[model samples]
Target: MTGSITIALDAMGGDDGPRTVIGGAAIALHRRPDMRFVMFGEEAAVRPLLDAHPEVDKASTFHHCDITVRMDDKPSQALRRGRRHSSMWKAIEAVKTGEADVCVSAGNTGALMAMAKVCLHTLADIDRPAIAAIWPTMRGESVVLDVGATIGADSKLLVDFAVMGGAMVRALYGIERPTVGLLNIGVEEVKGLEEVRAAGRMMREHDMKSIDYRGFVEGDDVGRGTVDVVVTEGFSGNIALKMAEGTARQIGEYLRSAMRRTWMSRLGYLLARSAFEHLREKMDPSNSNGGIFLGLNGIVIKSHGGTDADGFASAVELGYDMVRSSLLQKIVNDLNRFHTSDVPAVPAEQ
Candidate 1:
């Protein structure tokens, strides 16, 4: 677990299938040569691409399966049709069976999540699982959870997300005591839903040593990096994530339009080309490619289906980092401490 990590890859997942998936694996291999991959897909497509990159081929263990879970397929449809035969299912099965340290897929989010929950199951004392995204912030990065995993979360679930997201931050950022915040419309305790307020009170009262609870953080604080972990129910988290992405894209478009509007602006852009490039790199969604599913017994990383090799590589690297940092163990230990610290299992409504 400490050394070279083995990754279970859904090679046939994603928009481009094996080409993009294997290409990404190749890119990851260049960065982490010690890493090994267990690929699941049809040999006809995967082998040739693996041959293109001898290094990945040498380090890979291929499991051929003709079936693929379609991108448009619903979770229930995928479960019924692509159960044991699909590449995605097999990849997740590797993690469940202890053959791989983590499972990575750039496939259908709903299907991957469904399969993962079925195969790995939830960790002990955990009810619902959450999807945590590494959000880029002004200070650096913060972990935000329940980003479209489920619609709504109870107060207890929100508290669980905080603990889970805090573990993610610790694992990825190497912070011993990361700050946690409940996402609210306002910083005032009375501004949000009772669930949010209750969750915040529990996090504050519990005095969990692993996380530095920073109380409520507004949506703007997400970009400002007000906390290391942003806890929210899935509905609002997903909306906020999408809104941020849209705003970034809109800003990029505006920058381009403004630069092209005048020769003087173009000259200025040329003078600051390097700075602009750095900003673009920072804003690129590809750099932050993985949405981690937390509270599961095993690690499952979901990459954007349309991302290229470099983007996929970022997701793979994230999985490797999580395995190296022993994220699951950290979450489990934190959960044990949280349950034993005399914190009420159910927070009283305000």
Candidate 2:
């Protein structure tokens, strides 16, 4: 945590391109003076932006890349066309080559995942990588995994997500033995998919030291912070994440509309302005913008493409946290423990 950490940035990946990326690097550099950057993008577009931020310019080393992955490109198409030449690919390469501790990109999620999996590869015993997001909860925050990585998980994959998610909590929050629960329709043993139930049974029977399995958690339990980590397939996890974001936006709009409805409402809003501001800060999606690709041999952070400078900075800071905490090693240790345990084989789908 004390030493200098280098991060690889895909400057051309986001909706706003180098402008947002450079601005974000400046903010992140200001906060963490020990952080350095290796930026990958077209020189003509990115260099001027970098030069404008004197602090970021001094701390960064830029590399020119001719290709930029299109937001609409499919994962297969991205892999075929942008494998080696794209800005996103080069940024991830920096992590693989040890030039940077982690890679951060606000690119197409599918393209980023494709490039990362091909370049960095998954850690041993990891069948598939998962995207883990930090969820704001009633207690504080919780880690949720498979938030749109690959869809459809078997029993074994769910257990793997639990191990990875627990490791992530330990890395970010310093929780020694994080509690984990499967995201399900109900908390009962008999509810939800067979694979989920089997995973629950497996975790209960094995009782892994790295995580405390808390059985099934209903969707509502996620916001309540019933457990430190929530595990689910990408399909459901992605839906839950989108729904939460939409609901937050909806509530904010409702509040704004109500505040302007009448003179009395406007006066009440003025009286409670500070509290409203606090609520806005808590509900802001930008605060929790980074989605970490867990199970990779190297760290890759996916930032929301539409995010602004502050949101992108949050993603860079997340990459810094993962590097500082030795997240990869912690995951390896956890997975090793789980694989060596007396857990039963995953039952086939009914």
Candidate 3:
């Protein structure tokens, strides 16, 4: 870990405003004593919360910003209205100016992404940025990219996601040459969209050392942990993410209902209380709360808007890990190598 890592917080961005952000920062500080914070929000709303958490208050330098982006604000509207003054914009600016290593926000996702792109800009050769989420798979955890960052992707963009996701896997999981798979409807070479097929051929031919390109994977393969990184355009990626989350919740509800249906089942639940507790912990969304915005010049983490303090803390820790692992440098190195390598041209789309 670095001797000291500073995180910028959009202190008034989330559903609970300063309460959730401050509490999460306090929790993060507890786990990482070397962490410091630069908080931006309304002074009146944030100061009282800071008073409640002396550890975070002492470690933090607060800046008052009267404006905040609303959750429903469109991306363009946010950019126009909150550009220089809003808490979200200032938080991102801190990263742009090197005032903080990373920025964490549980704010309007659209607004946050917009401000981040405008403030820090995309890295060289990256056409668009992506959001990579740490997914809880049966085998452990996998990195899934383009989870609602943008709506569509071409072959080149898909390749970019693969490289970026591979870098993130290495940073977060210490997996060198992480296996990457393109999420598709089928595993066959000719089974998916032309763009996906083209992307696959490009990856196979280039054979980048940073990632082992597995041909294609179906939706079920994601939870099976068939690959260390799952790459897809944001449209399908976002749908897959939401579906998986809903399924987890649905299954949990079914289990609860089944256990409460009869005295016998309730007794069985009691007999297996420890196992259930472990299962609950494993299924907890809070454990994997942060979605990393990749392919950017700086690190920015977006937490679930409705997540509690613990979940937000998980997001902060994610930023800490990214900085500690030197994620941006790794991505740049991979991109440079991939582009400079002598490789065959991508065949024309059928």
Q: Model 1 over residues 1-350: C-alpha lDDT tens digits? A: 55789999999889988899989998999998899999999899888998998999999999999789999999999999999999999999999998999999999999999999898899887889999999999999999999999788988889888888888898888999999999998787669898888888787767787889989999999999999999999999999999999999999999999999999999999999999999999999999998999999999999999999999999999999999999999999988888778885545555
lDDT of each: 0.92, 0.93, 0.93
Give lDDT tens digits, candidate 2, residues 75-155.
999889998999999999999999999999999999999999999999989999999999999999999999999789998
lDDT of 1 at 50: 88
User: Candidate 3: which pairs clash?
Assistant: none
Report RMSD (Å) for each prediction in the order shown.
1.3, 1.7, 1.2
List ranges where model 1 is wrong by over 4 Å.
Answer: 345-350
TM-score, every prediction: 0.97, 0.97, 0.98
Q: In angstroms, how far off is 261's CA in candidate 1?
A: 0.7
Selected candidate, larger lDDT, 1 vs 3: 3
Candidate 3 per-residue lDDT, tens place, 124-237, comes to 989999999999998999999999988879988899899999999999889989999999987876688888898998998886878999889999999999999999999999
lDDT of 3 at 212: 96
- Tell me how many clashing residue pairs each candidate has: 0, 0, 0
Query: What's the residue-level lDDT of 88 in candidate 3?
Result: 96
